[model samples]
Target: MNRKRLEQILDVSLTMFREKGFDDTSVMDICNACGITKPTFYKYVNSKEELLRHYYDGALETLIQAMDEHEPSNDYVALIWIGLSMTASRSIDLGPDLLSKYMILNFHEHTVTARYSAGGKQRTVEAIRKAQEAGQIRNLCDPEKLFMALKNLSLGLTLKWIMTKGSFPFFSHYGRMVEDIILPDYDTVLKQTGVDHRKKTG
Candidate 1:
């Protein structure tokens, strides 16, 4: 399946859902919006709810691509921080409303949640090892264990944003949480990456 075509379907679906509400937005409504038939839609996703999973997974593509293109000798800690910054931006773009739906759906289908992100999660774990070797991350951090912690943190932050309706300075808060809890010395990482995440995140 053409991934661009799949993205198109997801984009149109989001727009329709925002305007029409998810419950009222039928598969045919999305199909009509994307100019794809039901069979074609099914080829892209098993169901509309699955689009939420695809959208969630799509947020990681930027990080994966960055990791793929990154030089091995560069600051691995900075690389991880920049990748996650982009991932956080992508999550915000997905909108809290959609994220809430995704959270609720995944809550009921907990087993399927991690299944959607297996490939991306593996790549992130690989990056974690690189970061650890660079001395950017504390050596005490176990790669897989750290990955689970960051994953849970991402979900928790998403819930926080939804509950607040984005009233807070999200990126700044996210930066503090990461630096203080998830990724130590992450401020230095952001500096090395040349990312003024404050500007980018807002």
Candidate 2:
């Protein structure tokens, strides 16, 4: 397989799916957009659904990488915020409709989506455990429960954003939730943990 060409096809297909919706975007549409013939497109992917699966995998891979790259800090809240921001930005990049379709397809499955979700949850649980050990999380709740709360909040906000057709500002909403509700005493936590809270700016 030509990796570069495959990427090009996926990119074009994602754009088409985002703009045109899944049902409306034909295989020929994707092929024409990629400047490839149907046969060539078939050589890479068997169907439009497969193309969508590839797109979902690509986005999930990005989030997994971001989660892995986050360095441990006493400001573990910031680390969580960074992961949330990355996820929100990726969903926004995919646009609402494509994201909705992706969610619907694998929302209840033990598939690629489930694998990514499990990996992300594991990373989050680890982060929470570290924070608890460092006394950043004063509540001393179960790490798994805390992780589930965070995950639910993130998923709920994303669902709302999609349902509203992108009228909602997910990134800003997530940041505010982190700053005001989730970690209102984040600065104090950092200080208590003897770690300076250095604000990360984009």
Candidate 3:
């Protein structure tokens, strides 16, 4: 019933769930591993799904906080580097399968799940908007559109990196590619837009 005991249970359950998945992990599996009885286990949680929700919820909150705290950088290239580094650090603590599986399982369950996913996308968009406003990104297209484009590139890079087990090293090259994308149209938009988006929040 205490916080420490609950945290221990959650940690144990997360490891087991990650290794064997939700369906394969049972209350008995958790209890036996933790030296607790079924009644004792039930005191903290009702089911495996609830535990998944807890982990998912905590991970998403951490991600949002990281995005919020990223230092404001002038250029899109710099921002991409900063963003990927933040992402790598956060993803390192959890399994690589965490985001993909959570997205697959909960993307359609409720408005809150949809909001969590959207919040990530929105953060990326806002970062780009801030960069554009700062005159650090090209302005040939809409800020939102540019954000989506950059997001797609990042997603592709992430998938490639995951498939190759870090062989591609997207983090090393992402900033340069982002720079290439924004540099061609920098002159027109850079001068026309002066909103200073780094000050905005999502």
Q: Candidate 3: lDDT of 77? A: 38
Candidate 1, residue 168: Cα displacement in angstroms equals 2.6
Candidate closer to the true structure by TM-score (higher is better), 2 or 3: 2
**Candidate 1 global lDDT:** 0.70
As a whole number from 0 to 100, the lDDT of residue 15 in candidate 3 is 89
Tell me the lDDT of model 2 at 95: 75
lDDT tens per residue, model 1, 1-202: 9988988998899889888878799999999888989999999899888887776665566667777777454566545556556666666776777777777887788744432266567776777787666555664478778767766776678679989887776677776666565454445546556544445545
Clashes of 3: 0
CA deviation > 4 Å runs, candidate 1: 1-5, 35-44, 57-61, 112-116, 137-139, 182-202
lDDT of 1 at 131: 67
Off by over 4 Å in 3: 1-5, 18-24, 39-46, 59-93, 96-104, 107-123, 152-202
In Å, residue 23's CA in model 1 sits off its true spot by 2.6
TM-score for candidate 1, please give it.
0.71
TM-score of each: 0.71, 0.77, 0.55
Estimate candidate 3's alpha-carbon lDDT, on a 0 to 1 scale.
Answer: 0.59
Put down candidate 3 lDDT per residue, 1-202, tens digits, no spaces.
6777778888998888779876688889999998988998889888655665555445546656766565432344344445434444343334445544444455456433322256566666666666666566555567567766765676666556555655654655665566667653344333544334334311
